[model samples]
Target: MPERKILAIIQARMGSTRLPGKILADIGGKPMLCRVVERARRAACLDGVLVATTTRAEDDAVEWLCRERGYVCTRGHPTDVLDRYYQAARQAAADVVVRLTADCPMIDPAVIDQVVGAFLAADPPVDFAANRLPDDRTFPIGLDTEVCTFAALARAWSEAGEPYQREHVMPYLYEAPGRFRIFLVRSARDHSHLRWTVDTAEDLELARRIYAHFGGRDDFTWGEVLALVEREPSLAAINAHVQQRTLGDQA
Candidate 1:
């Protein structure tokens, strides 16, 4: 059999309700979406990275940025993200798929490779793999990574009917444990306390501080950010009070 193509698809949009256009928001003089794309491309395990956005007129800016930056992009359903991921994977001819979000400007490429490695190493060959499974999350919120086979993605796309499952894109696979084998790769230490995602103004402030510390570079490792937070405990306090929306919460 030919080598499996591992594709990383970063889903982005300008219609965030918590922080409108958060994906286009600036961090270290670069858009958040660009930062995510740049970092994800550095993963040694990924064959390619694509920015998947919606066909909505508001997302035109996302497509424009991808074009200007010479990154591959695919357009799909604005709300039904399962369909979007399935279509993106199919179009890219991906045998293995990595799912990422533009809000995670601090996503670590090494962690991405780690998750992919775990997925590939599963004895029974899990249908889905992620650094932080829904219930047992250990990695920081922004460093979230999910890997799955194209067949699993297609299965979720066709079988999932709930709005949340369709919108969140992989809940179905893990939700029904008996149907799909799932694997969760956890960090040595629990860092779920850290919130680096750009979901609100305070979250953005924390991310900006991190980017500023790295001199606006996207190559910094997630460990470096952890150390920075360790030195300055106040940084994590910025969004400590911010409540993350539950899985059932609608867009």
Candidate 2:
């Protein structure tokens, strides 16, 4: 087990610019939010998983989802995602925070464990760790893990300015590079070609296609997703519409 209590904070909201109520959207016979929780729960290194959603009454449905399933849920400022994460960490008394998004339902638990393991194994000790996406074996889309210390997150909350900073926390640490001990993990296979996020209609269609392939199995692995997509190349083309976030891109 890891020394620091690893808390997975999944930032979610009912309103999405591209796909409204995407979190509440259905995939595999369950809400997208629940699927995200199920994947996070599969991580062996995580001590717990909490869905950090906004306090808006529109999101009351999300809270009810948690209550209905007996999963942990938290409420905070919707746009100010940084504060939301901070409050969630406080609630869980977490020392290490793993930032996940509710949009990423097919996020691999094994990938999360590998990153957490790397954080614990660093000799000089790392303030944070992440996978450099679009480089190594194509990490499945929608699955991003940022493992950082509570101390670092506090500093980010205090020092980080600008709306983008508040909107998408912790870019300062990764972009600053040498300021913190940062390490990147490469995927063993070319799984990065897979897209598993729900950002747009295209993305959702792809997810629906994937669900159809897997018959909405909750325990579906990353490999299984890739294999299905391989058999049906058209499924991968669903999200060929939107461009992915670039290194210089702001939230």
Model 1 worst lDDT run, 10 consecutive residues: 242-251
- Using all chains and alpha carbons, the TM-scores for the candidates as numbered come to 0.98, 0.92
Q: Which stretches of candidate 2 lie over 4 Å from their true place?
A: 133-137, 189-193, 245-251
Model 1 clash pairs?
Answer: none
Candidate 1 residue-wise lDDT, 1-251, digit = tens: 47899999999999988899999999999999989999998999999999999999999999999999999999999999999999999988999999999999999999999999999989978899998866798898999999999999999899999999989998998987599999989889998888988899999999999999989988999999999999999999999998877787743
Steric collisions counted per model: 0, 3
How much RMSD separates candidate 2 from the native structure? 2.4
Deviation from native of the Cα of residue 45 in model 2, angstroms = 0.7
lDDT of 2 by residue, 1-251 (tens): 44678898988888876688999898878898888899889999999999898999999999998999999989999787888998889878899999988988788898789889998898888988886533443477776888888888888888887777778877766767587777777677656656678888788778877877777877788778878778878878778667666433532
Candidate 2 clashes: the total is 3
Q: Scored by CA lDDT, what does every candidate get?
A: 0.92, 0.81
For this target, which candidate reaches the highest TM-score against the unseen true structure? 1
